[model samples]
Target: MKVGLYFGTFNPVHIGHIIIANHLAENSELDQIWMVLTPHNPLKKKAGLLEDYHRLHMVHLATEKFEKIQASDIEFKLPQPNYTINTLVHLEEKFPKHEFSLIMGEDNLKGFHKWKNYEAILAHYHLYVYPRISESTIPEQFKDHPHIHKIEAPVIELSSTFIRNNIKEGKNIEPMLPEKVWEYIDHNLFYRK
Candidate 1:
């Protein structure tokens, strides 16, 4: 199976995330798109982050009905401060027969050089980059790299932070979130101060 690993904190799964995942699965060579929920991302701030299981559940709720998208807690059992290189290596070892590709946004590509073992990631696995509004251009050096491919997948400007801020401000978040995920947040009173 050729899988596209879409990694994120997914503090709360929003429609934008689901859209990107579906677009990649339908438009790319990937047969499956896994929403890899990171327990702790070293590069991001920890403040306001929901518990791992809560975030994981939100991803599950958002993607449950999608045939191609899956919510994964693969990083929960892995070491803290999860690194992409380590997770990719582990996945390769666990599923030798499956081909894994990294799915990310164009914004991430700007900081690609800062990631740990980025060269190895570039060499070993294919990178399928979706366009984002900001910093949409790929660096010159990687523009023609065989393993790196930029895909024009449909994406929304909506972000998890925007959703959270809307919720906190008592604005209707139904428009920004998947129905199931909004229901889960409403029922559980999640992200309330």
Candidate 2:
């Protein structure tokens, strides 16, 4: 199986995530899209982040209906501050039959060169990048790289922060989330600071 790893904190899994995952799964050569729930991203601040299982549960809720997309907690079992390269290596060892690729936004591509062992990742796995509204240009080396595939997916400007902030301010963000995810968040009173 060819799988594309869509890594995210998914503080509260929203529709934008589903759209991108679905788009890649249906439009690309990937047979499956794994929504990898990162327990802690080295690049991000941990403040205001939900617990790992809560985030993972929200991801499950968001992706449960999709046939090609599924949620994963593979990183939760790995060491903290894990890099993409390490995860890829572990996945390859465990599931040797499956070819794994990366699913990232164009914004992330801007800093791809800074990642640990990025060259090794490029050599081993294909990167499926989707469009994001960002000012920075992708690195010169990756712009035309054969391994990096630029997908013409929709430009979804929505974010989990926006949803959390709106919910905290007593604004309705139900439409921005999957119906089940919204119910879970509402029932648990998540992100209501």
- C-alpha lDDT of all candidate models, in order: 0.89, 0.92
Can you write out model 1's per-residue Cα lDDT over 132-161, one digit (the tens) per residue? 889456778788899988898776798899
Candidate 2 regions off by >4 Å? 41-45
Worst 10 residues of 2 by lDDT: 39-48
Worst 10 residues of 1 by lDDT: 39-48
Error of 1 at 167 (Å): 0.5
Candidate 1 total steric clashes: 0
Native-structure RMSD, model 1 = 1.8
**Stretches > 4 Å off in candidate 1:** 41-45
> What is the per-residue lDDT of model 2 for residues 63-143, given as tens digits with 9 covering 90 to 100?
888999999999988887888898999999999999999999999998889999999999989999999998979989999
lDDT of 1 at 191: 77
lDDT of 2 at 39: 90
